[model samples]
Target: MVSITFHGGVGEVGGNRILIEDGDVKLWLDFGRSFTAERRFYAGWLQPRGHSQLMDLLEFDLIPPLRGLYAQHHLEGSPIPYEEAHYDAVFISHAHADHVDYVRFLDSSIPIYCGSGTKLFLEASETVGHMDYGEHLYKTFRTGDRIRIGDVEVEPIHVDHSIPAAYGFIIHTSSGSIVYTGDLRRHGPKGEMTEEFLEAAAEAEPEALIIEGTKIDEEEGGLSEGEVYEGVLRVLREAEGKPVFYTQNRRDTDRFRTFYEAAKASGRRLVITTWTAHLLSKLVKDEHLDLPDPMRDEDIAVYFRRKRSGKYREQDYYHWERPYLERKVTAEEIRRRPGEYLVCLELHHFPELIDIKPRGGHYIYSMSEHMEEEALEEELMRNWLSHFSLRLHQLHASGHMGRRELLEAVELINPRRVYPIHTEHPELYRRLLRGRRVENPERGRSYHL
Candidate 1:
């Protein structure tokens, strides 16, 4: 018997995760944080939102502290997994914290299957000094590579999302095939790779298909990520002075290029911080999406800023350091004539500049809700962006698959019993896959097939 259970990421965006089982062998798709919803719940430690609306924005299955998945550590001798859940593998689609951050809590022996880029970013050796992880066996496979663990033979078909080396997997079991789209977007520098992977999945004709529904609203429209880049470029051009683009990390190299070209043409500096520089270096692996170490000229001054404290020591710089060519600046630099500089910063950095400018510049809120407080405690959020005054535009694009692409992928794969695992809009997927046998399984409630 084969079974698939939706552990989280249903009826909500982000937090795409599930557990798929073929008899005794169990494997998890992705275990991401509920992010926005989780912060509001764990307010003190997380976002610290003050009585903000509940952030049950995304749903997750496992209980807190992650003991359920680890099969160890019980609270006051309560009911635990009778069988002690042991997964053969945990496959992560990309680097987005939602899918990868929770892995540290799981059992270390479970082998992790992911594309090369995903592994590169997770492992500390690739980025500056290595970060932390829970206990999990790390294994890497390329786009077309396959690996076996017990009865399951998994093939990673490369797909594009917001990040590099994102993928959907083809899991072969005794019963049939299960194609799980970890997370994906239709347009990027190497969009053809994602299309090819989807095309082949259609050819393989899997028994079941699981996909993401990040952009389910009717308003998302038909614009591809590439199309969004074009539109966002138009927005950048409207800026009369140095254009500062606050965005998520290096995944959107294509979009960055558009900004870079615009900045270069306008004879402005294309400044990037040390952290973003490191991320940029890893993404250049795809030949078609290459961005050389940014060279800052007199007109193109790339200002680099280090935190006042020494959280990231200078000695920690890695192999990519040569390319960054970074020069550190102080908070005072940002307050100087806002039009004279184009500075990029994430939400946390906003507080540092609060003393310098009190709202004249613009803020483009990029990235997912997973990173920020449900609402930045007014003082912290306002203080950060206060120094700079001006307009705020949310022209950022998505890194997850939209409703249409998910539908096309499902139709192409032609699964026998399609399960919409990670979506707030499983209904949309349901509407699109009218003729297919679809099941929306609940967490912990196992149904045998």
Candidate 2:
């Protein structure tokens, strides 16, 4: 008998952990943290203690208690005894925190598999933020690579998403094929990649389709990445003699490219922080991706803030940040020529506005609108922008498929049974895809195939 367990990503948006067991073969899909659960217990400075680690999280039932699945050190003081890895391997879908953050607690003996670009993302995150994902035997795979683990053979197909190197999986089991869509979007810049994945999934004729429904409730309209680019250009053109500041997910290279192009078209250099410059530098190594080299690109400039001792010193910043110091421009320089540059500033760095002080600039909010839980932060951000007399332009393309597109994709794939995860409105699928077998998975439940 073949069984699938929904450990996470049920009745929520993220924290996907799916266990597929066929006879003696067992493996997990994605081990991610639930944003909803994490916010409920921990907030701001009050976080889970490192020494107590698993104990703190397990106490709140934040992480599922799976024997022999976690590292011995993390399992210490817990009720479950330490044992050898009971699972075969972990197949990561991407490098998003909501999908791969929980991998830090897994046993190092179990191998972790992901795309080659995903490996680079993890390495960069560890180097800059000191966020350790523990020690694990890692294996990298690309599109069309079929990996065999015991009785199951897994094939990863590339999918378009907010982040690069996102993928969907096709698992060939003894019973039938199981398809897992790992945070895909069909309206982004690389929508063709998602089309390729859909074709492959349709050909496989999956018995079970595990898909994400992040925007399943929102029907009809949504902006594409191309539309977002046009919006950025419009904002830049209207800024006139004032500076333009934009904020987006730092990991979103596509959005960076959009702003880069828009800045160039507007005859302005795009100024980014040292951290973003470092990330772009690392990402440029991938020959397939067309990212501008921060070290060589004249259109790109690094923003260096006054560090320790109130001076711009190389030693003040981290080792990774020092590389971009040579191309640094201080706040005074930006203040002198505000209209000549488009600055990329994060919410935390809003204090820098006191120094750069533009008369009346434009602030492009190139990210998702604030969710209900983040209302206070949104209000504070608006207050800051208002204080500076900056015109706020909210232009963003969602990183998920719209309701109609998602329904169409499901119909094309034509899976025998559809289980919607990573969504709050799984029930919408029942109404949307009438006559199809739509299952709303419950957490910690085992469903046999």
Candidate 3:
């Protein structure tokens, strides 16, 4: 008998944690944080204490209370007694915080399996952002690679997503084959990759299909990556003589490429932060990914903020950020010639707007809209942009599949039993996928096949 447990990603988007057990072979699919829970318990500066993090989270039932799963350090002083790793391994689908953030709490003894690009992403995050995913025995695999753990043979297949090196899994268990789609979309630049994955999944004819339904709501019609590029180009053309400031998920390399190309076409240098430049530099090494090297890319220039000491000293910045110092462009330079640069500004860097005051610039928001109307950050962002007299242009491509596309994919795969995860509207699937074995899995419930 093969059993599957849904720990998270129920009645919400993101925070996916699934455990598969084939007899004694127990392992996890993805260990992600619940974004919905995180927002409720902690906000802004108020966060869980570092020393009593596990206890705090457990109090609210944020994390699963599984013994022998968490690291000893994290379980220190907690009520739950710590034990050695009981699981075989952890298979990470991608490096997104929602999909892999809670890996820090896992036991270091359990080996981690992920794509080569995913490993690089984690390394870059640790190097630049000081965010560590904990030290685990990592085993990197590429597309078409099959991993064996006891009786289970897991195949990692590449899939198109918001981030590079995202994958879906084909797990061969004693009962039957199980397919797990780890946050995939068929609308991005790499849509073909997702198609290939679906074709393979269809051929497998798995007994169980574990998929993500991030955009399975009333929301319809999404722009493809190409469309997004075109939209961005149009926006840049309109703001010909004014500065164009854009905000997007820094990890979305495809969007980065879109902005870079748009900037180049408009005869403007894409000014990125030192941290972004470092990430790009690290990503460029992956020959499979066609990321431009920050060091050699003429159209790219790094931005440096005036830190403490009142001087742009090399010691002020981290080692990863120091490399881009030579190619740094100051706020004064951007202020003097705003039209010649397309500045990438994050919400935290809104203070820089005061120094680089532009008369009437354009702010391109190339990201998803907040699900909540009363999102504090979005309200605050608008106030800042309004004060700067910046026109906001919302142009973005979603990282998830639309309703029609998702339904089509589900029909094509046609698994024996369908279980939707990472979605707020799982009922949509039940309503649309009539006559199919669709199961709306509840969190912490175990379903056997």
For candidate 2, give the lDDT of residue 45: 77
Instruction: Give the per-residue lDDT digits (tens) of candidate 2, residues 1-449.
Output: 77889998997888899999998999999998887777889877788997877888888888889887999999889988999989999999998887898999999999999988888899888988678999999999999899999989999999999889899999999999999999988888899999999999999999999999988999943888889999999988899779899988878888999999999999999999877887888888888777999999999999988879678887898888888888998889989999899999988899999999877899998887522223238788999999999999988888899889899989999999999999988999988899999989989998877
Error of 3 at 402 (Å): 0.9
lDDT of 3 by residue, 96-125 (tens): 888888898899999999998999899998
Candidate 2 weakest lDDT stretch, 10 residues: 367-376
- The deviation in Å at residue 373 for candidate 3 is 16
**Model 1 agreement with the true structure over 78-162: per-residue lDDT tens digits:** 3434244466788988777778766655666667777777776675333564445555667877766777767888888877776
- Give TM-scores for every candidate, taking all chains together and pairing residue i with residue i: 0.78, 0.98, 0.97
Please report, in order, the local distance difference test score of every candidate based on alpha carbons.
0.61, 0.89, 0.88
List candidate 1 segments past 4 Å from native. Answer: 36-40, 44-61, 64-85, 124-131, 219-223, 231-236, 242-245, 249-255, 281-289, 294-326, 329-341, 352-363, 367-388
Put the candidates in lDDT order, highest first. Answer: 2, 3, 1
How many pairs in model 2 have backbone atoms within 3 A of each other, for residues 3 or more apart or on separate chains, i.e. clashes? 0
Model 3 bad stretches (over 4 Å):
219-221, 370-376
Q: How accurate locally is residue 299 in candidate 2, as Cα lDDT from 0 to 100? A: 98
RMSD of candidate 3 to the true fold?
A: 1.7
TM accuracy, model 2: 0.98
